[model samples]
Target chain A: MEQLKKAIRERGKVLSDEVLKVDTFLNHQVDTHLMAEVGKEFALRFKEDGITKVLTIESSGIAPSFMAATDLGVPLIFARKKKSLTLTDNLLVSQVYSFTKQQTNDISVSKDFLTEDDRVLIIDDFLANGQAAFGLIDIVKQAGAHVSGIGIVIEKSFQPGRVKLDEQGYRVESLARLHSLEDGKVTFLDETVSVQS
Target chain B: MEQLKKAIRERGKVLSDEVLKVDTFLNHQVDTHLMAEVGKEFALRFKEDGITKVLTIESSGIAPSFMAATDLGVPLIFARKKKSLTLTDNLLVSQVYSFTKQQTNDISVSKDFLTEDDRVLIIDDFLANGQAAFGLIDIVKQAGAHVSGIGIVIEKSFQPGRVKLDEQGYRVESLARLHSLEDGKVTFLDETVSVQS
Candidate 1:
C-alpha cells in the first residue's frame, strides 16, 4: 500500500479533476513486485471470508485479480468486456456502463465457471461510480454465489460507490482512498489526513 | 508443459475443429499454480535473453505476463486494446486482426514504458494466426525496443502464425504445439503425440 501510494505521488498524472492516469506503473505498465504485495494484503484482509474465486472485470483489473488469486491460492474469473465469437450460450451476462468510455457494454462469464457452492471476492483497479463493481456483483448473484467481499486498489471515496456497496452490506476494502483533489492537492481519506499526491 | 497439456485434455472443450477452449484454466478462469509453472518454463526458455520487460496484449495475456514477470523479476508492460481519454499523446500503436472476433483493432502503449534500451519478451495465452504477436512485435519495434523472444502457452502449429513469426526471425517458444485437431483427437507436435478431448 505504501509503495502504491508512493508510486501514485511520483509517476501518476491527474488528467482532469476526475481521472487519475496510472499507466506508468499501476494499470497499463505494472510493477509486479508491488502488485504481489498488494495481492497478499487483499488475501490477508479477506482471508477468513471463505473466498472460492477471485472475480474482476477485464483490461485493468486482470493483473490485481490474478495476483490476488495467486496469493489466496484460489481460481480467478474475469469478465470479458466484449462478447467474442468463442463465447458460448451458457453464460451469465450483465450490462455495465463505463463512465470513462461513455458507453454501455456487456460483461459475461460462463455459467459453468460459477456455481452456488462458490464464494466470490470481487477485485478491481479503480472504483469510481461503482458501476463496474455493481455489474460484477450482479452477475455473481445471478450465479447464486455469495459475495464474500470487495477489494480495490484505488477508491474515490467522495464518489458514493463505497456508500452504495456498504448499504448492500458488502464489506469493501480499498488500499488508497481519495477524499478530494481540490486546488490540485490530493487530500487522502484517513483519520490522520495524509496528503498522497 | 505437461500440466497444461493435461489441463487442456481434461477441461478444455473443442468448440470447433480449429478452436480449442481452455478457458476453464488458462484464460477465463486461471489456475495460479499452473501459471507459476508456466512462468518458470518461460523463464527457462528465455533465460538467456536478459529480458528487461515482459510485453503482452491486454485481457488474456496479463495473467501469464504477471507470472513470467515474477519469475524473471522484471516489469510487465501490456499494450491496451483501445484508446482511452486517460491515455497520453505519446504512444506506439499497431493494428491487429482477430480471426475469432472477425474484426481489426488498434493496440497502443504509452511511449514512456517502452524504450530503445529495453529488451522485451512477448507472452500470450494462445498463438493461433499469430496476428496478436505480430501486432505486439510491431509495437515494440515502433518504440525502438528489442523483442527478445516470444512465449506462447499453446501454439496451433496448423496455423500460419508460427511460420510467419519464424520468417520474421523472432525466436518463438511454445509450451504445447498442436499438429492437428481432426475428428475428436488433439494431436500435439511433440516427440510423443498425445490425444485429448
Candidate 2:
C-alpha cells in the first residue's frame, strides 16, 4: 500500500481535479512487481474468508485479480463486457456504469463457474461510484454464491462508493485510498481515520 | 506443456471444427495455478531473448501475460480496444479482427510505454488467425521496438497463423498446439513433427 501510494504520487497523472490517469504503470502498462505485491496483500487480507474463487471484471482488473487468485491458489472468473444486448440462459448479466468512460456496459459471467458452494472475493482496479462492484455483486448473487470480501487496487474515497458498500455490510479492502484528487494534486487518505470504516 | 495438453484434452469444449473454447481455464474462468505454470513456461522459453516488455491485448491475454512478465522481471503492456474510431496523436493504433466475434476492434497502446531500445515478447491466449498478434506486432513496430519472440497459450496448428509468423521470421513458442478439433475431439499436434517448424 505504501509503494502504491508512492507510485501514485510519482507517476499518476491527475487530470481536471477529478480524474486520475494511472495508464503509465497501474493499468495500461502494468508493473508486474507492484501488482504481485498487491496480490499478496489482498490474499493476506482475504485468505481467512476461505475464498474458493476470485471474481473480477475484464481488462484492467484481470492483472491484480489474477495475481490474487494465483496467491490464493483459486480460480479467477473474469466477467466479460458485451457490446450486444443478447442474453443467454446460461449466463448471469449485470449493467455497470463507468464514470470515467461515461458509459454503461453489460457485464456477464457464465453460471457454470459459480455456485452456492463457492465463497467469492471480488477484485477490481478502482472503486469510484460502486457501479462496477454492484454489478459484480449482482452476478455473484445470481449464481447463488456469496462474496466474502471485495479487494480493490485504488479507491476514490472522496467519492461515495466505499460508504455505499459499507452500508450494505460488505467489507472492502483497498490498497491505495485517495483522499482527494482536487486541484491537480494527489492526496491520500489518513489510514488511522479510515481503518474504522 | 504436457499439463496444458492434458487440460485441453480434458476441459476444452469443441464448439465446431474450427472453434475451440477453453473458457473453463485458459480464458473467462481462469485457473490461476495453470496460468502461473503458463507464465513460468513462457518466461523460461523467452528468458534468453532479453525481453524488456511483454505485450498482450486486453481481457483474456492479461492473466498469463502478466504472470509471464512477472517471472521475466519485465513490464507487461496491454493494448486497449477502442469502440470509437477516434485516434490520438500520442498513441499507436492497429486494427484487429476477431474471428470468433466477427468484429473489428481498434487496439491502441500509449506511445510512452515502448521505446526503440526495448525488446518485446508478444503473448496471447490464442493464435487462431494471427490477427491479434499482427495488430500487436504493428504497435511494437510503430514504437520502434523489436519483437524478440512470440508466446502463445494455444495455437490452432490447422490454421495458417504459425506458417504466416514463421514466414515473417518470428520465433513462436506455443504451449499447446492443436492439430485439429474435427469430430468433436481435441487432437494435439505431435511435438516431433511441430518442433521442425
Candidate 3:
C-alpha cells in the first residue's frame, strides 16, 4: 500500500482538479511489478474468503484483475464493453455510464461463466463515481452468485463512490485512497489518522 | 504448449467453419494458471531479446501481455481503441479493420510510453488476419522503437496472418498453430511434420 502511494506521488499526473492521470504506470502503460504487489495485497486481504472467480470490466480492469486472479489462483471473467459475434444472448447485462467518455455502455458477461455456486471478487483500476463497480455487482447478482468483496487499486475518497458502496453493505478495500487533488496537489488519506478518526 | 493445445481441443468451441471460440479459457473467462504458463513460454522464447517493454491492443491482449511483461520484468503498454480524455494529441495512431466486427477502429498509444531506446515484444491473444498486429507494429515504428518479436497464443495457419508477417520479415512465435477448423472440428498443425515438410 505504501508502495502504491509512493508511485502515485512520484509518477501520477494531475490533469485537473477532477481528473488524476496515472496512465504513466497504472492504466495505459502498466507496471507489472507494482501490479503484482497490488494483486498480492488484494489476495492477502481476501485470502480467507472462498473466491471462485474475479470479475471486472473491460480495458483498464483486466490487468489488476488478471494479477489478483492469478495470485488468488482463480479464473477471471471480464465484462465486455461491446457485444461481439461470439457473445450470444446468454448473458447477464447491465448499463453503466462513463463520465469520462460521457456515454452509457452496456456491459455483459456470459451466463455460462458465473453461477450460484461461485463466489466473485470484483476488482477495478479506479473508483470514481462507482458506476462501473455497481454495474459489475448488478451482473453478479443477476447470475445468482455471491459478492465476496470488492478490491480497488485507487479510490477517490472525496467522491461518493466509497460512501455509496458502504451504504450498499459491501466490503470495499482500496490500495490507495485520494483525499483530494486540489490545486494540482494530490493528497492521500492517512490510514492511521482515518482509523483513529 | 501442450497444455494450450489440449485446452483448445477440449474447451474450444467451433461456432462455424471460420470462427473458433476459446473464450471458455482464453479471452472472456480466463484461466490465469494457463495464462501464466503462456507468459512463461513467451518469456522463454524471447529470453535473450532484451525487451524493455511489451505492447498489445486493449481488452483481450492485456491478459497475455501482462503475463509476458511480468515474467520478463518489464512494463506493458496497450493501445486504446478510442481516444479518451486522458489521451491527448501526444499519440501514434493507426487504423485497424476488424473482420469479425466488420468495422475499422483507430488504435493509439500514448507517446510517453514508447521511445526510440526501447525494444518491444508485441503479444496478442489471437493472430487471425494480422490487422491488429500490423497496426501495433506501425505504432511501434512511429515511436522509433524496435520490434524484437511477436508472440501469439493461437495462430490460424489457414489464415494469411502468419504468412503476411513472415513476408514482412517479423519473427513470430505462436504457442499453438491451427491447421484447420473444418466440420466443427479444430485440427492443429503437427510441429514435427510441419518442420520436416
Candidate 4:
C-alpha cells in the first residue's frame, strides 16, 4: 500500500484539483511489480471471505484485478463497458456515468459468469464519484451474488465515493487514499502505512 | 503453451466458421493460473529480444500482456481504444477495424511511454484479422520504437492475420493456432504442442 502511495506521489501528475493522472505507472501504463504487491494485499485482506470471483471494469482495473484473482486462485471477470445496451436476456447490466468522459456507459457481465451462489470481490483503478462501484454493485445484486467488498488502487477520498459506499455498509480498502490534489500537490489521506524499502 | 491449447479445446466455444469465443478464460472470465503460464511462455520465447516494454490493446489483452510484462520485468502499456481520434500532438495513434463489432476504432498510445531506444513486445488476446496487431505496430513505429515481434494467446490460422504478419517479416508466436471451426467444432492447426499435465 505504501508502495502505491509512493508511486502516486513520485510519478503521478496533478493536472487539476479534480484530475490526477497516473499514466506513468497506474493507469495508461502499468507498473507490474507494484500491481503484484497491491494484488497480494487485497488477497490477504479478503482471504477468509471465500471469494468466488474477482470482478472489475475493463481496461484499467484488469491488471491489478488479474493479480488478485490469480493470488486467490479464482476466475477474474471484467464487466464490459458499452455505449448502449442491447437489452440481452443473459446479461446482468448496470449504468455507470463517467464525469471525465461525460457519458453514461452500460457495464455488463454475462449471467453465465455470476450466480446466486457466488461471492464477488470488486476491484478498480480509482474511486472518484463511486459511479463505477455503484454500477458494479448493482450488477452483482442483479446476479444475486454476494458483494464481499470493494478494493481500490488509488482512491480520491476528497470525492464522495468512499463515504457513499461506507453509508451503504460495504467494506472498502484502498492502497492510496488521496486527501487532496490542491495547488498541484499530491497529498495523502492516511500516510500511516510506511513504504516497504 | 500446452495449457493454453488445452483451455482452447476444452472451454473454447465455436460461434461461427471464423469466430471462436474464448471468453471463459482468455477474454471475459480470465483463468489466472493459465495466464501465468502464458506470460512465462511469452517471456521465455522473447527473452533475448531485450524488450523494454510489453504492449497491448485495452481490455482482453491487458491480462495476458500484464503477466508477460511482469515475467519479463518491464512496463506494460495498454493502448486506449477511442471511437474517434482526438488528434493530440503527443499521442501515437492508429486506426483498426473490428470485424465483429463492425466499427473502426482509433487505438492510441501516449508518446511518453515509448521511445526510439525502447524495444517493445506486443501481446494480444486474439489474432484473427490482425487489425489490432497492425494498429499497434503502426503506433510503435510512430513512436520510433522497435517491434520485438508479437505474442498472441489464440491465433486463427485459417484467417489471414498470421500470414499477413508473417509476410511483413514480424515474428509472431501464438499459444493456440486454430485450424478450423467447421460444424461448431474447434480444430487446431498445431495440436502438436502437447498438453502439459
What C-alpha lDDT, on a 0 to 100 scale, does residue B79 get in candidate 2?
89
A66-133 per-residue lDDT for model 2 (tens digits): 77898899999999887322224588999998776778889999889999999999999989889999
lDDT of 1 by residue, B1-197 (tens): 89888887888888778988888887888888788788889988887889999998888888877878977889888898888788847889899998878889999988988989999999998998999999999999998989999999999999999999999899999998988777867878884545765
Ranked candidates (TM-score, high to low):
3, 1, 2, 4
Q: Model 1, DockQ value? A: 0.78
lDDT of 3: 0.92
Candidate number achieving the greatest DockQ relative to the actual structure: 3
**How many backbone clashes does every candidate have?**
0, 0, 0, 0
State the weakest 10-residue window (summed lDDT) of model 4 chain B: B82-91
lDDT of 1 by residue, A75-143 (tens): 988898877777768889998997878899989999988999999999999999999999999999999
> Which residue segments of model 2 deviate by more than 4 Å?
A83-89, A191-197, B83-89, B191-197
Residue pair clashes in candidate 1: none
Fnat for the candidates in order: 0.85, 0.91, 0.92, 0.80
Off by over 4 Å in 4: A83-89, A191-197, B83-89, B191-197
Candidate ranking (DockQ, best to worst)? 3, 1, 2, 4
For candidate 4, what is the DockQ? 0.55
lDDT of 3 by residue, B124-160 (tens): 9999899999999999999999999999999998899
| Candidate 4: tens digits of C-alpha lDDT, residues B1-197 | 67887888888888779878787887778999998889889999999989999999988899888778998999999999863222245888899998878889889999999999999999998899999999999999998999999999889898999999999999999988888889998878765465758
Candidate 2 deviates by what RMSD?
2.8
Error of 1 at A175 (Å): 0.8
Q: Judging by lDDT against the true structure, name the best candidate.
A: 3
